[model samples]
Target: MDYKYIEQLIERYFACETTLQEEQILRSFFSQGNVPSNLSEYADLFRYESSESNIHLGEEFDARMMELVERKSGMKNKVVSIRGKFTPLFKAAAIVAIVLTIGNAAEQSIGNRPSEGFDDVTAINPYIKKDNISAAIKVKDNTQAETKTVVKSDSLLIENND
Candidate 1:
């Protein structure tokens, strides 16, 4: 009728300080049907432990577990084609090619336009000087004027000789 010892053992068990023998004592004490109302709550716990300890896995248990493991492993393996494995690489290459093509086309279009905010002759030939161009035009005009004057003087001389 003194459950003080059982109570002390339970306290030690929960504290994880009880020896194996002490734990067995607690199990035996609670297994009995005459537990007081205060200790009845712990009775089911110990009785379940007692019942579960007697249970053993049958010979088929290992086979069943292995079969389940094999089934899971089989599911993990997939059939991948050569194309499937290289699909990402193919996509990356295609994207790179498209980008390069667009970049080249844009470069050509930009280069073909006339240079803006700059002189057209200078844009075409960077080495030509504005002073040299003006001097060449003056020389051409002087030569044309001299040729016209010589032709008029010659015609006048012929008319005077006749």
Candidate 2:
């Protein structure tokens, strides 16, 4: 008779504070066709739930659902295998990338490098004659030999002073 309790329960439901028993009471009350005029707006909502609760999916529904699931599973396996098929290509690409990186670094190190050692100064200045290197070495040996003789002469002077 009184709709105040139903209005209170509906408010509590919206606020998420209503218990399950209170919700059930509201659903049962609104499922009846004799709801008051002011509560008519909520009757269709509660009646729809009561009608939906009676629906039962038969074997035909289960068979159709299984078919759809099998189709989706087949598609999923195909996509997974497709990705697996590309794994070798990805590995080959990584190998090529590593080789290219190493090759580039080797090329950069070798580039702009000077020629071999300067054993012959002629390599540095090509106009110099090959025979000049031997001449220079002889001059260096003679200078070193003269320096040793001067040091020996100094030692002899010190021994005489002693």
Candidate 3:
């Protein structure tokens, strides 16, 4: 069979003008081992393609990759668990701090109060004037004189009747 079309495609492949499908056709045709003497130089290129097509990551590589993925996932879970577990404790500590601050403020207010218990009462009655005392004494003496006059008048009327 004539290989002129295949040779033309191979030239296009070297020029980087062949599509992937065209390159695949060239590799398939060269794999049959009937390549002409003039095209033997391109055998190595097609053989390299075949070998590359057969290349694969082994089971060991897959296992290592899976293990790495699992380790990363586990570390993420650990971080989430740590944050979830400590959130409540952090909130409780904040609440306790607020309560202690309020309690301390109340205690300080009670401790700093004025020591004098009667200061407010004394504030209501600031000073006793001398005139107010004299007025009270005069009213007392006027009531006593009125009582003596009533007693003397009753005694004089009883003597005149006897």
Candidate 4:
């Protein structure tokens, strides 16, 4: 038997260059039990393809699939009220309001209290002693007193000269 055409079709089929007609021809050729010994290796592949092509879904396939889908969706169709949906947002808003109120009260209390640490300059500064400040005040007072006496003396001299 001349199997040159069958061999060529099989090569084209493996190379993915065979048309649907050529593939059907290959399946028909292999379906016959009298395939040549040299081409027997590809017989199972074409036979499996032919057998799988005969397989199809039964009439109840769609109905069974819809039933399973409805059964699962019945559990998923839970009802959520408007209040239930907004409960988390309401809780978060309440927590924020409470936190802000407590923060404002604490700030007011701290602000109203006397700030002893900031009011006393001596507590903040170790280099400036009370004695140094008192000495500086005394020097400024003495300078003012000396200036007043000098002005009085000058006025007396001016009156005598007149």
Q: Whose TM-score is greatest here?
A: 3
Each candidate's root-mean-square deviation in Å? 12.5, 9.6, 11.8, 10.7
Q: Of 3 and 4, which scores higher on lDDT?
A: 4
Candidate 4 TM-score, C-alpha based: 0.39
Model 2 residue runs over 4 Å out of place are: 1-54, 114-162
User: Higher TM-score: candidate 3 or 4?
Assistant: 3
Question: Which residue pairs show collisions in model 1?
Answer: none
- Provide backbone clash counts, one per model: 0, 0, 0, 0
- The Cα local distance difference test for each model comes to 0.86, 0.86, 0.87, 0.88
Tens digit per residue, CA lDDT, model 2, 1-162: 777988898889879999988878888998876889987888888788778889998999999999999999999999999999999999999999999999999998976476664453565588876677678878889999999999999999999999
- What is candidate 3's lDDT per residue for 31-132, written digit by digit as tens? 886789999988988988898889898999999999999999999999999999999999999999999999999999986777663344345465756576
**Comparing 2 and 4 by lDDT, which wins?**
4
**Candidate 1 lDDT tens digits, 35-149:** 9898888888888988899998997998999999998876665334556788999999999999999999999998788666336567688889988777777999999999999
Ranking by TM-score: 3, 4, 2, 1
lDDT for residue 7 in candidate 1, whole number 0-100:
87
Ranked by lDDT, the better of candidates 1 and 4 is: 4
What lDDT does candidate 2 reach at residue 148? 100
In model 4, which runs have C-alpha deviations exceeding 4 angstroms?
65-162
Two-way lDDT contest, 2 vs 3, winner: 3
